[model samples]
Target: MNTFLYDVKTKCPVCGREFTYTKVRMSHLKVLERRKDLYTKYDGIEPFFYDPIVCPNCGYAALSDVFNNISDEGKKEILSKITTNWTKRKFSGKRTPQKALESYLLSLYCSQLKNDKDIIFAKTCLRIAWIYNILNDSSNENRYLKISLDMYKKAYEGFEAYDGEIQLIYMIGELNKILGYRDEALKWFNKVINHPDRKNHSLIVNYAKDEWQSLKI
Candidate 1:
């Protein structure tokens, strides 16, 4: 059963009695045997370690809400709604994570002024690309990755956010590495590592360091 911690102090919903903040633990009474995977857009590729919230002052607080909490049935219903415009009108649309990601990106390529939504969609495409690459789906992975890189390049040219720039370059390096574009990967890795604006993110920095060192050997 999935469990989380919350601040249990508050004016009790049952009775209006305000208590001092106190931490409390709460668990799902029912264990939903759901597949634990990053199956949504905008959630990056990382292992989920729950660091639940606590508000001792409140005595009853919502914890572990960092992750979305939707039951399988609920998620299916939502997905059905999400895909109603483009695909079959069933809750169980058999839409894989990759498909959902691509569909989402496709929907974002509007002729009007693009904003954070378009960039976020590009990130989702990259995530799906990275997943497929890891799963050995080279063809689909490369396709999504190419699209992501194109969008990222556009963002890089258009905006000046350091974090976004670092990510854009880093992802290009990663995809090139997987695709055996060694020189291209090296170029991107060097650009990120040497760029004045790039932050030393754990994911990007560590990967760049390892690959840079390996290339030396």
Candidate 2:
């Protein structure tokens, strides 16, 4: 186990197996800045390195936030489609960036099998894109960025279960700018700028103005 990372015991929601995964120590994280792309830079350890946990025994994997929220039916589905054919592999001990990416990818695969909401999958893709960004791997970064953007758009247009419509609009605008969709970015930015409640969220409003100005330059 890496000194910077600590072991976290978790129960697999899909297979009922106990496992341990590495997590970055909170005390070690040093935040550098909040990028326009929404990724937070860290000086010491990356929290995202421990975001996805995988069960080595059954190949069940998901982000920590959603890992324990599985339904009985979802478990059955994963067992049938994922676990049954899954070649057992362990992800214990210290984790490299590449290993972390692999765990997120497995979680993504499981999310698809469970027919997870677009938002759920989009968030995963966004994290993957951020990971690639940290690695300076432009090809993979753009690939996941496009995937995440598409899913976020879908979720915004059709998913009523998701809260924070205004924030989602802001995110969509930021994502568009990241993808070089300047016109679309401006459209959403303006929407936030002109919203009735814009005054309530000074931070988001300020960000919208800054991004909107950048587009005009």
Candidate 3:
């Protein structure tokens, strides 16, 4: 079947250069399977494999959510640190898993360069870990997962409540469990099960319950 991936026009926030970035049409996506941690495998092209858009003119890359939301300071930083050293490149064609990994890592670097929120860094690192998981590079995958878990922990400690906060807390517990930090995992999981927000987020509540129970067995 033909993959419904196409190019979308984008203006680089850092350099103000027009470029085309590839995206998968969501309506055409076919999910083959979804893993316990919510890693999805698609029948065709993976939509998430194209979640980041990189400006070919400059090296500024970001996840779609933050692509156009750069602050003036962020733009200045990107221009100084990335664009100034960037050579023209293209990421507009069909992307391999490795290419997608490269794009995500670049976005992670850019997020750090711009001093974006811990959530942004955590999300980028999570995606990088997922890519490594797909590649069966368990060492690299776990390394990024550790980084993501730390970032999430920091965000949870310092940030105010936001959308999906319940999910964030659940992820911290789950990541801790995956990393063999059983005590820490149980601590966070206990918090999730007792959190008032858990009532409103039934999905996370159920998942947390399941994980918590499984750990006790």
Candidate 4:
């Protein structure tokens, strides 16, 4: 057993089967850098590899944050669509980049099947893009990034006010910049800088300002 990772027991909401997944120890994490799009580079094991929780019993997969919150309709969908075809496999051991990519893609599929929030789709797509970036696969990276950007735009258009709105706005700007949409990126960054709640999110406000200024130069 790897000392940096530990097994976490969780009950599958879709199938009611108990299983364990691997999670990196927080103390062992060493952040080397954080990209503008919020992808972090770590010195040791990549914790992002474990962000998606997969059930060995059923094929239900989702980001750890939203794993236990699936709807009744979602459970029915998973049982009918995913669990029926799932092969018994374990994702509890150490994961390679390929395994991580598979896990994230599974989560993305499940999210779409469940009609989850656009933000959830955006988040998952963004992580898939980040993993592709790590693999130096620019084609797929841009592909997923574009999908993520579209989802974020849809989410922003639908929400009037909600938690993390500021951060969501900032992500739109950052991803636009990363994807080479200079004008769109600048417009979004300015929106963040001038937002009514800007003062409440100083960190994101500063990031927006930095990106905004960089674009002008």
- The candidate maximizing lDDT is 4
Candidate 2, 94-210: lDDT as tens digits: 667888899889899889877778888888999999889878999999999899888888988985344467666788899999899999999999998998878777788789899
The candidate 3 region of ten consecutive residues with least summed lDDT is 159-168
- Candidate 4 is scored at a TM of 0.95
Residue pair clashes in candidate 3 = none
List, residue by residue over 182-208, the lDDT tens digit for candidate 3.
Answer: 888888888889998777988777888
The Cα local distance difference test for each model comes to 0.46, 0.84, 0.85, 0.91
Q: Which stretches of candidate 3 lie over 4 Å from their true place?
A: 160-162
Off by over 4 Å in 1: 1-118, 130-136, 160-164, 197-203
Per-residue lDDT value at 34 in model 4: 84
Off by over 4 Å in 2: 1-4, 159-163
Model 1, CA-based lDDT: 0.46
Cα lDDT for residue 89, candidate 2:
82
The residue-by-residue lDDT of candidate 4 on 1-217, one tens digit each, is 7788999899999889899999989787788998777788888678889999999999999999889878999999998988899998989989988999999999998998898889989989998998898899999999999999999999999993336788899899999999999999999999999999999999889989999999999
Model 3 Cα RMSD, Å?
Answer: 1.7
- Cα lDDT tens digits, model 1, 1-217, are 1123233433422113454322223232333332211122222222111122222222111223311333445334433433234342211122344443443343233111122333554555665665575568889778887776676666666674534577667766766676667888888889878876656566566677677677657
Residue 188 of model 4 has an lDDT of: 95
Cα distance off (Å), candidate 1, residue 79: 18
Using TM-score as the measure, which candidate wins?
4
Model 3 residue 123 lDDT?
A: 82
Give the number of colliding residue pairs in candidate 2: 0
